[model samples]
Target: AQSVAQPEDQVNVAEGNPLTVKCTYSVSGNPYLFWYVQYPNRGLQFLLKYITGDNLVKGSYGFEAEFNKSQTSFHLKKPSALVSDSALYFCAAVDNYGQNFVFGPGTRLSVLP
Candidate 1:
């Protein structure tokens, strides 16, 4: 009853521009949301989380997300993208009781100079 889906496998953007990674979730109860980034064999780095209030949450590396209750979506966003920002982005959600954690396959972001 809890899961997430990222329709796109990759996103291409220009450096110094904005970038976004899409994510949507479904759960039976209130969810704890998180975003993580992994850079080629590196440990997953936490980006942000949405536990309760405030639909918009900011996180590490100039990244942020908007939690939309009506749409059941939490999308990652950044104003200015960097070539170094290119990496694998993952969206995850946990049940209130911590029973399960589901992750999207991943989105590979590429920023061109």
Candidate 2:
């Protein structure tokens, strides 16, 4: 069984400051991790993915994530926070054998100007 976890329910950041959303996972084999963002009443948009490669993977909108195999963690990060960057973020993991993707409880980001 594979599972994803987002420790924080919400993250608040000031505009122009850096922001981070933590995520962790449990899987039987090598994990395929992904990050997605969702807006109100809209479908989730893919932000980034870590299939294989460098430990640090960059993604859309200046977002990046670090994959730590030892810790089974993938934490999302942004260099600068924007008021418009406020949204719900989700961390997901694909089952090693199965094709299903299990998503973590979303983390809402609130950027205050």
Candidate 3:
């Protein structure tokens, strides 16, 4: 079985400050981790992914993620946050079979100016 979790239901950050959204996963075999963001009434937008190679993976919108195999964690980070960055963040992981993709409950990020 594969599952993903976002312990924080909401994250608040000041503009231009660093931000992080934590994510953890439990899966068999090598996990394919991904992060996505969703705006109001908008679909999920791809942010970053971790498949292999480097533990750190950079993605769109100046966002990056660090994959920790030992901890089974893939946390999303940004050097500086923006008001427009406020949205719903989701963490997902693909199962070993790659047929099922488990998604987290989601975390709402609020970037205040």
Scored by TM-score, the top model is: 3
Ranking by lDDT: 3, 2, 1
lDDT of each: 0.93, 0.94, 0.96
Which tens-of-lDDT digit does each residue in 51-73 have in candidate 3? Answer: 99999999999999999999999
Off by over 4 Å in 1: none
lDDT of 2 by residue, 1-113 (tens): 56799999999999999999999998878889999999999999999999988999999999999999989999999999999999999999996675778999999999999
CA RMSD, predictions in order: 0.8, 1.0, 0.8
For candidate 3, give the lDDT.
0.96
TM-score of 1: 0.96
Instruction: Give candidate 3 regions above 4 Å deviation.
Output: none
lDDT of 1 by residue, 23-107 (tens): 9999768889999999998999999999999999999999999999889999999999999998999999988888789998889
Model 3 residue pairs with clashes: none
TM-score preference between candidates 1 and 2, better one: 1
**TM-score versus the correct structure, for each prediction:** 0.96, 0.96, 0.97
Displacement of the residue 55 alpha carbon in candidate 1, Å: 0.7
Q: Judged by lDDT, which candidate is best?
A: 3
**Candidate 2 segments whose C-alpha is farther than 4 A from its true place:** none
